[model samples]
Each structure stands twice: as structure tokens, then as C-alpha cells.
Target: MASLSQLIAKPATFSVSTPRTSSGQYRPRRATVQCASSRGGERSEPDAPKHQDRRDPRRARRQCHRHPDVRASRRRRPRRDARRLLLRRRGPSAERQRATCCPPPSSAPAVDFTPPDAASLPLRTRPAAHSVTADYVAKFNAGIAAMKALPPDDPRSFSAQASVHCAYCDGSYSPEGFPGVELQVHNSWLFFPFHRCYLYFFERILGSLVGDPSFAMPFWNWDAPDGMRLPAMYADQSSQLYDPRRDGRHGTPKLIDLDYSGTEPRFTDKQQVDHNLRVMYRQMVSLSPTPSLFFGSAYRAGDDPNQGPGPLENVPHGPVHVWCGDPKQPAREDMGNFYSAGNDPLFYAHHANIDRMWSVWKGIDARRHTDLTDPDWLDASFLFYDETPQLVRIRVRDVLDTGSLRYQYQDVPLPWTAARPTVTRRADSLLAPAAQAAAAAARKAGDFPITLDEATSVTVKRPVAGKRSKAEKASEEEVLVIDGIEVDRDVAAKFDVFVNAEDHGAVGSGGRELAGSFVNVPHRHGHGRGRGRGHGKNGGGIKTKLRLALNEQLEDLKAEDDESVVVTLVPRQGKGKVKIGGVKIELMH
Candidate 1:
């Protein structure tokens, strides 16, 4: 019945030992800190607990009774009938719901098309920013100019193309059956599919305008060290590719921080590159080994569109947006704000990289080559105007394979796959006897398992005076290890973790109190085999630990003598649940 903080207050005795590796180096085996807990707070010391099988009929029935969305899905009937029922349930909001229940008057021509044969269509290769040739640059500039020259009303025109992003993302439209609910597509499962289709049509429009069916959109390859700078082609003031409303501070020579929130840190170019590569490895290779983790949570019919973003979307996708937007401008217009993001010419190029990641993710292994099988996910539809100025209804099922869409990206080296952070200092040397004792005591503290359903903060009070050493005081760095993060295998939930954040909403707005994020990689049923070799036999839900290097975050909190440190978890979107079994802090030497 003791709280984690209370347990930490009463120190527990422990010892540390140094082990040697085959390389004749002293490898410190970190003491095993067992802090596992079951649903009823029963303690367990197993190495790793097996996640609950989602395919179990009993578990499904239990979840169905507990979750409102699951219950609604079970009772779902025909679309028309469901709309009527949803509207009636709106009560006083019924009048507003009627507009969405009825179809809008269509003025745009309908699109009729056949899926193009992959072999027959020309493959438009999007080259990386660093590898783009002078000839390719010329073509890209020409294509942009031609698109810009088109009339404002033309769907292929630059203005019209930008408006498409504004309309859908900025709440210009609502779901057909849910009138009062705004259709916000940024933070949900729709993030990937919707943007994929948008870029597909936009690329086609550019090709048509340039009179070259093979003209491909260039991608801003920010993942690699060489491609970290904003592509030089877009910075040319005289070129059509140039956008005047970008962050002046983020011009050429400034490296892109994949984990950028808002503030700039003092990291050497090499350090920044190494950090970026490590982040890429974590997001693409380690964290995301399944479709649900890669693509994000599902947003089906009659559901809200904020059900969490995948790792790719949450990280580089969002940070890149904030990094590019002019900080001086109100709301960071152009690339920063959702409604005006596409207005910037570089937006398409930036998204081209995001789209390229999807292709690269699929090619990583055979098990990851599949898409979501849920009928609601597969059949989810969005409206967009294609090259012909004809409104087309694109389904999630239509764009699963990029090859079928008649485009591809230039193959590039994935340096992050082999990137592993090396420990320069010996653990014993870094942790003095006193520090070691403190760490062991902290580990013995009872685990605190908190379920995140909404914005919540937990405060842990621990005296800091006696815990500090000369090295710790000089470095002011520590490691925060969170163990046993478990989420439902079927739900793609993600939450941003923050320490000492006064306002949860402002956590990632360039605040110094921001900690890392916890992204869930959900289980895929009937996949025969799992995507990554790490999954092994146990593959039901996201159950893993996070070791965050919190030197900077802790320094920002100035909690050296503070009695309590508040940790906050903010869900990216919609409703999803996650449970954390324990938290530990160790000195990082």
C-alpha cells in the first residue's frame, strides 16, 4: 500500500559489481530493478510479463463492454440508419448535425479512373536533397513555375493546391454523419493515408502542368547527416520553389533536429547528427516494428479524428513543421500552422520525405508489407481534386502500395539502422558510492502504475541535497528510466511525456520541461510472423521500457534542491490508454 515516493524516502540497501567484456573492457551490468505490477497492483518479478492476448474472445467481450467506441462499433448497422441514430443522439445539436447528415451540393466534375499497371507507368523518382543534380533542379523549378502560372480556380494551380490542405486540416469540413464534429486529420490514423493521397494528386498535377509525366517531386531528406539542411533549391529567392515565409534562422547550414520542440540547444554539428541518426533508428527501426505503430491509431466512421499519431508523424513530421515555420510570425504561419502548412512551396518536398519513409518502412522486412485489415480503416474515404480538376473520392485501400500509385523515391543509405550509442564512461566511475546507494534506493521504491486517459500529472517528492556528487553537480545530467509501459494491442495510442510542465498543452511548444514521448506499437493479428526480430514469440501489445537521457530536461527544471518533480503525460489525440509500472532516475556520467 506504500506509494512509490514513500518507498524512495525510506532507502533500501543494495550493492553493485563490475563485469568484464570479451574486449577486455569493464562492462557494468546495471542491477536488475524489478517493478512489474498486474491490473490489481499485485507485484511480480518476471523478466518481462506477457501481454494480454487481444484475440482472446473473453478479452474482446470485456473490452467491448468497457469501451464506448467498441460498444458502438458492435451495434453498427447500415450507414444511413447509423447516421439517423447518431443525429438523434445529438439532442440540442441535431439542427447543426443535419447539414453534415445531408450531402453538399457538388459542382466539381466526378473523376473516373482505372488503377494504372505498375509496370506500365513511368516511375517518378524523388531524389534526396543532397543528391539532386543541376538538371533535376532545373526541371523541378520549371514544374513549380508552370503550376504557379495556372489560374487560381484550376485545381492544379498552386493556390488551389494549397487550399486543399487548409480545407481538410483547418476544420473547413465535417464528417458526413457527424455535423458538429470538425474533420481534423493531423493527429490520427488518417495522417498517413490522407497525406499520401494529397501528395499523389499534387505530384500528378505538377507533372501535368510541366508537360512531363515523369517529373517527380524532390524530397527533403532530413534523416541523413548530409541532407539535414533545408534544401538549397527552395532558398533561391528568384525561383518558384522559394517561399518567403520560412524561418530565417533555419536557413542553409542549420541542421534539422528530428526531436526539435521549440528551443535550440547547444550541440555540436557532429553531436546533432549522431542524435538525429539515433532518433531515426528508434522511431523507424526499434519503436515501430508493426503497421499500427508505423501508421498510428484508427479513426473510423462516426469517430473523432484525434486518436494519436504514429511515431513518424509525431516526431520528424511535427518537429519539422515547427522548425520550418517563422517563429516571429503569428502562429508560425506557412509551414508551422496546420491550415497554412501547404501554402509553403517546401511543404510538398518535406512531405515527400515523409511519404518516402512509408516506402522505406515497407521495404525494411516482409512482415511489415501489409496494411490495416479493419473494414472501417480500409474503407475510410476522403475527397480531393485530382489533376483534371475533378473531385475524386480516395479510399485508404486504394493507396496501400506506392508502386501502384506510379511513383518511387531514389534509394538512399539508411545509416541509422546500424547506429548505436556507445558508452564512453564506465558506470562505476560515473556513479560514486553515495550516488550508487541513492540509485539502488530509488530502484527499490514501490512501482507507481498510472493509467493515462486524459491530461494528467504525477508529482514525486524526493530530497536532492544528500544525493548529489561533485560529478553529478558539474554535469547536472541524469537518466530517467520508465519501465513496463503497456497499451492495448489493437489501439495505436501515443502520449508526449513531460517533466515539471506547468501547462500540458504548452509542453511541446518549445518548452524546456519537455521529456521524450512514449509511442505504442500495437499488435497485428494473423500476420503469421512479426516485423522485427526483436518481437520474438511474444507479440500482442506494446510492452517496453524507455531510457531517456534527461540531462537537459532536468537542468531546465532546476530541481537540484526542489522537493518535488511533476511528470505529465499528454495524449496526442483521441482516446487511448497506457499504464506505466515504474520510474527510476540515475546519474548520467
Candidate 2:
């Protein structure tokens, strides 16, 4: 395999349609995102075939599978106003899309024929410049040096005090912006790259402060049913860290409060919508809770603070694994307008995982990875920060050439590499007695650990769940393909859409649904309080689950490959405004 230097130095190809930098090279295709307030034009198209399918099969099977009687289920506990993110769940009619996996009478291959594993492929290795550990340290120093160069009132300085400004409002940030774009660099495509960039800087600062350059990022995925507690880095009592139940009054992370064991997920109009900002208002803004005396104004749910219901209360763990994002983080609102690569702190690592998840998705249901050829969805563009920290724009086409990029993550074995999905094995005794008792209750209700693929057959000894409004059961199998990527049919199995703005990791809806919503409410008027109840600052707290789907339909990705199978996925949604940096997920529940 070519070295990392070759990947970074690979020349970017472009046409008038695909934007290129002043250097006139497609180096890292990033665009200077212009908000609704800026001059806008549809992006230039590329010369490659609209759709390209290059999924790695080894990873797909991990998405999920059933042994024989496995069931698909979701419980609609009580609906709290906040959890009403991105509207409601809509899918094809239960006829084909529901959780049942019994195949209809057909002669289709029981499983698609597998091409022999591509003959031995070369391994990807990096030289000193492309090294993850090395770059991490260098970038850390660069950020610190840059931070020191900024004035006291500069935004970077404000970050030191956890005083992020409202990217929209000229004032301090709110996790969500108020009226204008947050930082020029913030936007939808930028979410991952930006945060990864932020984390690079943040990690360096932390490393510099503590004398530990090797401190890896503490991912919060430890909350699975089996690994359901904060990782030891944050939750160890001996560490003497800040407890959520104790010092939890901040609209910020504590000095070292990486623990996210808030017990249950946050629900309620104010709590749910606070950070998961939407794009309905003049601009999206972060509504994360604060140490202040009161939660602010809202038409719904927000009590008079002086009156009933109190100031936006939190119903913790009402449901777990939920979160919204900071509008300042990109990838939240739209993929077409920004660069997502360089913005995220965990960009490389996170995508490594997401890419891994895609492999897992197709592995679970080989057919689910086919792209439904659709048009509008195919021509999307996103932004990213390059290895040089220069914001460059990219398209779905650009991502296909992963080897040409500067970063490639360390190899981590997939969860489903085993014959049968071990899923996640935990010592049953690891739970606190209370949690253990709770697990028993959940088990009785068939809500214990679940491997989500609908193909998997397992017994759910309990009565299955539902609030199925006939229409609620999606039957029409409309397929959506965006750029060249196919949303695995089982996207929903791995993710749960939520309301906060700063919460990243969940899938953002693609365009079709938003277009539908636009067709429904042609005017840009308010639609009540949206999912956030009356307290949401704008749009509604909206974020997609890690499930394999987009928010819309695309009929544009059919290449001349008879070996490829066409699959459908639901894309994430986007209203008319800019919701930048919604991609930066500070914390996810």
C-alpha cells in the first residue's frame, strides 16, 4: 500500500462544478461555506460515475443478525416533549420494513454470492508525518501556540473559560447560535473534522498540562446494555471526579468531568431540545443547561420559572443513549454546504468507527447496502479540515478514495468477527446491585441487550412494543442513495435520533424528508414548538441514529457494475437555513 505521504500528496481532480482552492488543486475538497445570508449557488458536479460501491464485506456482518426467533422492538415509554427530535419516526409499511424477518416467497439467492476475498491486499502504513500519535502531539502544540497568539477577547480565549459564543449572535455562544453563522469555519460538513480538530488541540493542551501525550480519547460508547456505565476514566470513584448528580450545574464540562453516567437519557422539552438545535429560527443556537438561575424563554414547556412545571426540568434516563448537538458543530444540518473532515475532534477515529459500522451494516444484511439511484441526494457536498488545518471541501465522491486521504486509523477488530455475534460480553456481576435489579426488570420485558439486525432470529419472550398508527408503519420501500454512499437498510438498528445540538455520532437526516417537510409547510413559519416543545431555540432538537439510512431519496448512483446490488436508505433532513457545527457532538447520552 502507498505510504501516508502518498495519500496526502495525492493530487485532487476537479472540474468547474466541483469547487477547487486558489491553488487550483482538489487537494482536500473543502468549500468556504456560505450561509443563507451569503451568496449561494449549486455546487459544480464531478466527472466520475455518480455511484460507486466499494464496501468492505468483512465488516458488514457485524451490523446484526438473528439466529431464528430474534425480534425487532422499540418501546414508546412516555413521550417527553424534549425527545421529540426531528419530528417523528416514519418508515415503509410493516409489510416489508417491520422487524419481522421471514422472507417473502422468492427465489433470490439465500445470500448474495460472495466474490472471493479480493486477492491479498497490501497493508497501509504511515511515515512520521502521517503518524496518528505524532501528528496528535504536533497539532496539540500548534493549537496551543495559536491559542496563545489570540487576544484575550478572541473566541479561542473564550473557549478556555468554556465560554463558546453563539455562532449566530455576536454575543457568547449557546452551543446553538442565535442569528448568524457561528464561526466562519463552522458548518454541516465540518462537524467531524472541526471537533476532531478541537480535540486535537484540546488533547494537546491536556497533554501539555498533565505531561501525558499519550492520553487517548475517551469514547462514550461504554453505555451499551452490557457496558452500561461510564468508562473507568470518568466514573471511578477513586478518581474523585465531579459527579453528574453532585456538581452537575454547568452548561459546561467540568475541569476533567469526562463521566457521562447520567443514569437515564434526558427528556422533556427543554432538556431534550437544549443542545440538539434545529434550523427553524433566525439561526440555530446551543441550549445546553447552565449554572444560571433560570432556563430562558420559550412558547412551549418552559414554565414561567416563576410558575408551574419549573424552569426546563430534566427527566434523566427517561430513556438512555439520546442527545442533540451544538449547531456550531457541522454535519448537523446539511452535508451540501460545508466541509466535515477537519472540524471534528474525533474525525479520524469517529469515521474509522462509522466506516467500521458501515462494514458491519452490510455484513448483517448484504442487500441493505445497495444504493437506490436518486438525483438531488447524489449531488451533495460537505466540508472538512485537511492535515494542514486548512478547511477544504469534499463531496461524497471524494470519500470513496479513502486511501488518498492523509489519515487512516489504527486497525481495531470488529465486534462480529466471531462466528456468532458475541455482541458484548460483560460479567453479569459487574453491575451495581440496583442496576442488576433493573437489568432483571428489563430482561423480563425483553429489553435486555439486543443485536438489532432484523435478519437475526431470537425470541423476545415478552409482548412486542407498538403505538403503530397505521401510517406510522412505513410500507413503501422508497430507496435513497446520496453521493456515492449507500445507507445500509438497517441504519435505524444501530442508532437512535435525538434532540440536542452538541450531541454528535448519530446520523444526520439526508434531504428527501426535509424536501417533503418543505412541500408540506412551504412557508418558513414556525410549526408549534417542534420536537423540543416550546423551549427549543430553533428548528427542533434533531439528530439521526447510527442506523444505516439517509434523510431522503436519490435516484442518481447507478454505475455499470452488474456485480453491485441496489439498496435503499432514508437520508437525514435539512430545513432551508444553515445549521453549522451541529456535527460537533460534545457529549452523547
Candidate 3:
């Protein structure tokens, strides 16, 4: 082999030729270098003759490009001394063009984010909408009026605040570095914390307008039977809280359907109340038993938005939005759709109750049902203009504590906690042996990636049962995962999910067959007038997954030892708009 010193002295030579393009721009051409000897025992390259056209600019350029020594010598040249010469040779315009073409990709706008510290402000108690006093209603109305009076351009104005909500929920903005992917706060772990931060700033803005530092907002206590109807305050047409773009039939004195599916139920007042309580019970307790089951699927940076929604966000949460929205309008404007939801003054109260549920969920099972500890969940941040009209970036971690935010929901009776769904029917009793055998055959024959134009069912195989401790089986749950859900982003769609059910239509929360649902409130693509709300372009399709905890259901169905479970999907709204990719069951740790 050649000595190291000799190899260094006679380094391999190469050249990158700059070919002229049709646009009169020089493009660098790929150059190849070869060793002097293939075996590398000794390698050498002849030096160029020193007398051969040394002053010719083209020859000098080729020589410089070909040799490493020339490049080193160029860097060693004093920059200050050669600055004028290089500038004169290239011309300022050429240099500018080069810099422009090679501009740094890191120039994305720096977010002016500041995580807030523990608040020292006096705790503000948010009153329930139905229970608020006459004075409280007057103050809240005044605040809303003042906000509406502000110019649309003002960040603290009601319209601007509505726009903020629209932009985040709808596919208006993308995450940093992900210019094409939407920044959706719904349908994932971000749902709770993002709204908490949003409400915190909004409440602050409202209080500032009303000149009450300790002023708190009201929560629509729709979970309770007495507060199931639209709050009387929002029903008053003359009040600032009223929004014309709502279901006219679903006004005060008409109870809101917690699991509304666009069709009005024939249930009387008492029946509706009982049904609504069961829905709350199912979504909060039965369906959501673990942190992952409650918070939703993980969505990290660069990941596509709308990974999935938790049980609460799927049912009463989505159903309530659709119930309040005007059905006559295209895409269910105002309360029914994401972009126009914030336009309704009741949106805040509705969300306040939703936010309260986050706290309530933690209280239900302090050991298991807790906030997700994922760092991505904690660090996920959003930008919002505060009461001062200053852009402030808030993280999920900052709003996890309502006390730190200096606000608390009024202590009220949780009637749904006692309304836990009891097993009223069993699959074996409802499904005859023949029907059960037919279901198994259908699951075996059913194809993957089925369209949801009508009722669909496919039996998916569960994980093979292994030897596990009794404690392990009790703590760990089996989760049914419906993966690769593709749907149009602009449509309001819903489909109820059932596991091991004989008839999906007949099953309700009373049966173990009824698992949960997946729903979407239509949202416009960009900030344009499109399908759902505002003048926005249509959005690209959404691909997401749905997860349901099925431990209790498996026991009720007596399918703990069974290898496969029949999964049924019944389309209640927006049929032919959704596609299911596949289904499987996994063990939830």
C-alpha cells in the first residue's frame, strides 16, 4: 500500500463542469473520480504542466475545480482583501440571486410562545348555565355584547375569537414544518387541553371587557336532566348569547338529545332523560376506563391530524354539537360544524361543560383514568391572541390544572355517575346458534376495506389468549381497534360501532353489544366559503383510527374465551361518505 504521506501528497483529482442551461443559468454537472490503481498497492496522478495556459480563465477554473489544493488555497485567501474582487467579478445582482435560490429552509416563522406560570389570580367559579342568577346572566350578556361591539379586526373581538376557533379546528393551519398536514386539535389527545387553553384566554378576554378580573364564564350543564334543554339565556332572541344559526326546533323547553343522530327520537321527556344519563355513563365510565382510552390515540409532530377521538368526544360530545346546529343549513352551520361552532355564544358554555368532564373523568378513577402522561401530549402547543391582543402560545401542560388557570366549575351533582349501564341483554340470548354461526361465517368471508354505504359488519379475530395472572387480566383490557378510517374532511358524518352484536339497530347503551361511535362535525378546508362554513377550499380526505375498550363488553357477551368477535358498523348519517380499512383487537396495557 502507498504510504500515508505519499497518498496525501498526491490526492485524487476531479472536476465539476458547469453546463449552460436554456435559461442562461450555470448548472453543476456530476463529476466522476477513479483511483490510479484498482488494487490500491500504489496510486499516482501526473501533475499538470505549469506552463499550459495558466492565465486563461476557463483553464484556471477547470484546474481549480479539479484540485482539492486549489479549493483549500481559495479558503485561505484573506476574505476582507478578496471581498471587493469577488463582488466585482460576480456582480451584486448575481450574488443576490444565488442567495435567494439557496435561502435557508429554517426561516419558518418563530412562534412567540410563552408557557404561563401558576396563576396567582383569585379563583373564578364558572356557574352552570341553568343555575346562573339573573345578575350573572346580565353580566355575561353585557360581556358578550361588548365583545361583539369590537371591530372584526381586533383579536379580542367576538368574530376574531370565532375565527381563532375555526382556524384551529378546521384545516386552516398546519403544524410547523408540516405545511400540508392540518393542525387539528379535535379527534386526538389534544382535544381536552387545547380547548382548555382556548377557553382560558377567551374567559380572560370576556372578563377584561366586563372589567371584572375575577369574572368567570358559565357552563351548559347538559349532563343533568334539569339542564338538558338549551339554556334559557341563549334561547332569548334579544340576548347577545342567541345565535340564529341553530336548530330552531331544539330551543328552550325542548330537551337536547345527548346521542342525537339527526333524527328526532320518539322518546318522551322521562325516557329521553333516562337515555341521556346512560349515554353519559357509557362514554365517561364504561367506554373510557384507561388513560389511553379516555384521552385518545397518540398524535405527535409531523403526524397527520384526527388520529381518533375518545369515547366522550365521539358520542354526547359530537351528538350535542349536531343537535344544536341548524339542520336546514348546508353542512349544519354554527353549532353543528367546526368552523361556525364558535359563532354561537353557547359554544363556550358547551365546551366549558366538556372541559369540566376532563376534571370529572380524573375524579372518577384517580388511579387509572388520568391525563395522558405522554410528553407529546404535555408539550403540544397552540397560538392564541389574549385579552391584550398579544399573540401568546400555550401548551397542553399549562392548562392541565384549572386551579393554576384560576378557574373552577361550580360543584354540582353528577347524576350520570349512578346511571352506569347494566347488562340488560346478552348476545347468546339475543343471537341464536344459527345466527351466531352465520356471523362467524360472514366475518370469515367479509373483505377488508369495505365502504360504509349501509350497515356493515365483519368479525375480527382477537389476540390469542395466553397464560396471564388473574390480576393481569383484571388490570389489562381488550380494545377493539377499527383502523384506517378514510372520510372526506368537509362532511358531517356518523357511524355507531358495535362489538359481537346480533342486531346493531336494536342494541342501545343498555346492551353490551353497543360499544361506541365515531363522528365528525363538518369543517371547511381553508379560510374560504366551502362545503361546511366560511369561504374556504375543500379539504383533503381524513385517514384516522377508532379505539374502543371492550373488557366489560367481552365479559357481558361471554366472549372472553372466544377467538373472534363480530364487529358491526351502522351508518346513522352521511352514508356512502366513509370507508373502513380493517378491524382487529389488541390487548391494552
Q: In order, what lDDT does every prediction score?
A: 0.54, 0.21, 0.65
**TM-score of each predicted structure versus truth:** 0.61, 0.28, 0.77
Question: What does candidate 1's lDDT look like per residue over 1-589, in tens digits?
Answer: 1111100000000100111000000011111111110111121122322233323446433221110000011113233321111110111122222111111112322343345675645877878877888888888788888877877545567766775565445433222233233344555667887788889888888887777878788889898888999889988899888888888988888998877656685778887888788777656754455576567665543444345566687677777887887767655667876656777989998888998888788878766445777655665555566665555656677888887788878888889777643323232331356533433333132546766667655555443544466555445435555666665433445566666544556333234455667543222121111111112133323345554545434444555555455566677532446776777665432
Whose lDDT is higher: candidate 2's or candidate 3's?
3
Q: Give each prediction's root-mean-square deviation over alpha carbons.
A: 19.6, 23.2, 16.6
- The clash count for each model shown is 3, 135, 6
Residue clash pairs of candidate 3: 528-534, 528-535, 528-536, 529-534, 529-535, 529-536
Q: Per-residue lDDT for 1-589 in model 2, tens only?
A: 1111100000111111221111011111211111111112222122322222212223212211110000001112232232111112112232312111111111111121111122322222211112335445454444444544545333233122121111110100110101111111121222222233333333334434434444343332211221223223223233322123222232222111111122223434332232122211101001111111011111111111111110111111101111211223221211111121112222222223333332223344344332212221122232222222233333333333224332333443332222111112122321346533433332221232322222111111211122223232222222111111111111111111221111112313221112111000001111111221212244232221111111111111111111211221212222122111111111111
- Model 1 clashing residue pairs (backbone): 262-510, 306-573, 306-574
